[model samples]
Target: MFSFRFSNGPAAALLTAAVLLTVPGCTGPGAGQAPATSGPASGGGSPAGTASPGPPGVFPVPAATLSIPQVVKDVEPSVVTITTQTGIGSGVIYRGDGSIVTDAHVVEDQQRQPFKSVRVQLADGTQTNASVIAIDDPTDVAVIKADRSNLPAARFSTATPEVGDLTVVIGTPLGLEDTVTSGIVSGLHRNMPPSREQPQGALDLIQTDAPISPGNSGGAVADATGAVIGLSEAYLPPSSGAVAIGFVTPSATVTNVADQLLKNGKASHAVLGLVPADLSPEIVQRFNLATTTGALVIQVSPAGPADTAGIRAGDIITSFAGQKITQVTDLLAALRKAQPGQQVDLTARRGTDTKTFTATLANTSNTG
Candidate 1:
């Protein structure tokens, strides 16, 4: 069985030596632990040869493709090592004024609470204290403001890379600073289900063959032009019989969440006001579901959008906003694309009846 584990450090105790499948958040060195089995959950850039200024705080993509060494020289300065009380991880400078973006788990204490401040080590080995600006746990994105200034912010590409595109990962793995790895984009739109270890719920991630070890979380994954396209998030360990399979949080999400947190001190998510679960054979047999596939509405939040739309716990969500919902990940992905307060059509099957209802999505906030 293949298991997913977050590549952060101070490796945790091994739960089992057998083939275990679980996705735990990466922390410091030796922090590896068995992950819990879960079901599926849920760009950048500019054109070449343009002299125009890109988006604010973003660097325009270079016209020419860069070599691996060139890419490293371009991006390494923007990557930093983040050390919290519990563990160490990596981060990318997000702005010239010392704003750094990293995985939320990187700055969190052992109890998973965000620290008010942590230490940051820049590429040149300049160590400084950084205050936690905010954290959105659901998305696993966090922002911190270092005491220093005039940092080299990485140019983040908004364009989505195609499968087989070149990727280079730079981070501090296992406390070894300045680690670099290279690979190709293995897949796109990969969904990872929420687990106890990663409560960020279902995540839509970019799949790559880049080697991501512990302490690589929040590190930069740059493209051929040296423009960062994603942040290292998780990886399948060697014990899982998987090689070179890793996951990343796309730059689009990192920027979006960071922007929201910077603007409002919290990140907003479209909420349907219900708990969705995958429909199993047992559930189908018990509920006599009309279809064997779809998200099972196991719980409905009171006064939430779904509840207001008259959705019940026994309903099976078959579609959302005109998209077919084959499973919980589908529903979550659809929700990710939606904005709060937007009215959309949702279809569900209750017993032998299929019903469609219009729901105004609600907004939920996550803060540090």
Candidate 2:
């Protein structure tokens, strides 16, 4: 297997363009996002006692404050309900020519959960048969292709969002056709292990406070102006003792994963073979460390490349290559951009001395 090199330029621009041209939809990350229309606003009806009838969602987006009716009318065409013989999910249109993306678990058998045939139901309730055009299970994403062209595509966002922003979630969740919910972004660079629900792998989930349901999988989670920023994957169950928490795969991750699917049906991520902990102020005070922030290597995997390079616990990783490591995800983003097996330089602080080391990469499940 070969290492991956996904430059975050060309395709990212295309995704941004698609989103800017699209209208407001729905969202649900973990916290801090635009508010959603409370309760499914029924149909293209005006809000209680409001004389003017707005678009389907009634959310103010872009140039004019688009009404609920306008949002529904503009974005509905691009929200496709994906269902297969094995499972069902959602997919937002990415191109005008019937190219859409959804969670790979809903379409691929990488986990041996067989999918016989896939079908996409448009917002108009028109169902078109589709096939697996591309898939990358490491990211739990897949792209579907159909014979139809000139279809409506959803909008995408380029800026990395801040926590505490309003979020809107739109999908046919749990088989619910065309349902939209609202919430706020709570956390950023959330690294969570997979559960019984999400089967691909650990994800750097964008945590939101939106209401996500079973059928909400693979839906578009966007911010103000109806531009997508993340893809809904899982939600904190009501019984989990959590308040309106939802999880999403960030747009940056989505763009990389989607391009791989469109190109070779898969994508790869670099692995450092160590679990990292962000050294917060409290930890700094306890350790009386030099810098207030840096990534502390907690455990090094015995079989990982980092372990082979003699990376050990108690090593405070301050930087990777030339990029400063303010957080683990920051390092993750940088590594994802680097090709596996490629040499990487790091600045580590052991006690009072700063050191540098070079490590070769490793690839697993077709990616590194």
Best by lDDT: 1
Q: What is candidate 1's CA lDDT for residue 116?
A: 98
What lDDT would each prediction earn against the true structure? 0.76, 0.60
257-339: candidate 2 lDDT, tens digit per residue: 78776776556556667766667688888989887667788777775767877778888888887999876556655665676
> Which residue ranges in model 2 land beyond 4 Å of their true spot?
1-69, 109-116, 193-201, 273-304, 307-342, 346-356, 362-368
Cα lDDT tens digits for candidate 1, 1-368: 12554443212221111001123456555334332232111011233223457999988765688899999999999999988766678999998888999987787765556899999999999999999999876677889999999899898987778899899999987777999999999999887664445422436789999888777888999988888998888887776677778888988889988988888998887777777777889978885667998888877777777889999988988999999999777887888888878999999998888999999987774110
Runs in model 1 lying further than 4 Å from the true structure:
6-24, 30-62, 366-368
- Candidate 1, position 353, lDDT: 89
**CA lDDT, candidate 1, residue 121:** 94
